[model samples]
Target: MTHDPIPARLAALKTTSTPDLKSQWRDLFDTEAPPFNRRYLESRLAYRIQELVYGGLKPETVRRLERLGEELDGGDKRKRGIRADRDRPITGTRLLREWQGVEQIVTVTRDGFEWQGRPYKSLSAIARAITGTRWNGWVFFGLKNHRGRA
Candidate 1:
């Protein structure tokens, strides 16, 4: 019968030193080791070893995961690493408000809000620019009631 070296190699990872693990990480992943803890190294090493023998995740699985991540963070790579707040409207949603007989329209974007071809980090800034006074953007935009109800 043909011999399998994967089990022995995987078992050896448990007793491997930190330095050796880092070296192995470099060799297997073809890059520098991350600044993570020992457990992270061991787990990643174990995964890498198995990946080398059994292959990696299927392409469809990877695509599905990426699609899910995009839905969570609106496909913003900077926000991809962190959990984003869900209170904001989805991208491309238009927020409309009328002030002093003029209609103001703001479009929600992945990064922030857009009003009159200008990008704003917060609704408050847009409200200030429109009124030259401090106002809660959510309240001014009618997104939240003065009593804090949505």
Candidate 2:
């Protein structure tokens, strides 16, 4: 004879009381029927096995669920809307920097060259201030220049 597991027994009890719980949840929302609340309850119940088997709550698991919640809560929709409003292609500009030292990213744009979070308003002005005719590229594509010869 096989013994029923504690979790299995608890789960059966929880399942049998779902309708009453759902009614209470719906009442809390001041609605005769709250589909969203019922869905939330279903999701919570689905994670019961993890909560029962694991001694402690997992931070990574919670973080992943939080990220999913953000996406489901219209975060991605807002980002897509913002991108659509911009209507400009993202520049293929790259950043050159060192991992250990403070480096300035210089972008040559229509307005001018921006360096270290400041706009120079002219490339000539930046060239005149830097002392060298050519500057080495340090960081490319978010990675350190391993060759170090740049």
How well does model 1 score by local distance difference test? 0.93
What TM-score fits each model? 0.52, 0.23
Which pairs of residues have clashing backbones in candidate 1?
none
TM-score quality measure for candidate 2: 0.23
- Candidate 2 per-residue lDDT over residues 56-135, each given as its tens digit: 46789889987886776666655544434132213435244443375545664555456666776543455444535533
- lDDT by residue (29-98, candidate 1, tens digit) is 9999999889999999999999988999999999999999899879889987665566789899999999
lDDT of each: 0.93, 0.50
lDDT of 2: 0.50
